[model samples]
Target: MDSMIKTGIIELEEMEFYAYHGCFREENVVGNRFLVNISIRTDMTRPMQTDNINDALNYVQVYNLVRTEMQQTSNLLEHVTARVMDSLCRHFPDIEWLRVKISKMNPPMGGQMRNVSVTLER
Candidate 1:
């Protein structure tokens, strides 16, 4: 006999913030808008059977982790993105996979680009 474990994905998209994360002095001082998207994959077997909050990944805590990291300024989106992933790993051992996207809106790169973003997965 074989048993299969149930898995589920939780996504948080378009979470906006006003953060200072860039190399330019103006960007660091003035701050800019950022959008974060996170997709977390984990086993949901316990949550499914128990129907208890403790058995599932608490999104409020996840959001707090994101907010805490976002508040700290970074020179590169990649660095901040990595920090976010690291935080998730520290908090949630059940996460089997993660995808994180950090977007800086209206980056001052001397161009008409709307945004620049970095996506990381593991």
Candidate 2:
């Protein structure tokens, strides 16, 4: 029931940033590592044929966009994920589909957990 839908994936994985994005007071004071994984499917045939950077989807631009979203603090992972997806969709109408996972590494949840993540698709 769950799998990657497209082979033509433009992926950026484990892009890490330290940010304050939790409801707790400590979370705001002590930022945590957030890893962003982005996947996009779109028409890349033209870019492949032309060999022009202009013709291709720019990863740097996408990364910057994600960074801008990540820098802003939010109390909920859902809100952060929504912002990322909304921003991407607004900018890239050509993208047929997109999926994003934002993970908070080693969160202070008072339990032993590796990470907490939220995934959004559109």
- Which residue ranges in model 1 land beyond 4 Å of their true spot? 1-5
lDDT per residue, candidate 1, 2-87, as tens digits? 13768889999999999999988998999999999999999888888888999889999999999999999999999999999999
After TM-score superposition, the amount by which residue 25's alpha carbon in candidate 1 deviates from its true location, in angstroms, is 0.3
Candidate 2's TM-score: 0.92
Q: Provide the RMSD of all predictions against the true structure, rounded to 1 decimal.
A: 2.3, 4.8
lDDT tens per residue, model 2, 19-80: 99999999999889999999999887776667799988889989999999999999999999
Q: List the residue pairs that clash in candidate 1.
A: none
Once fitted onto the true fold, the runs of candidate 2 whose alpha carbons sit more than 4 angstroms away are 1-7
Q: Pick out the ten consecutive residues of candidate 1 with the lowest summed lDDT.
A: 1-10
- The models' CA-based lDDT, in order, is 0.93, 0.91
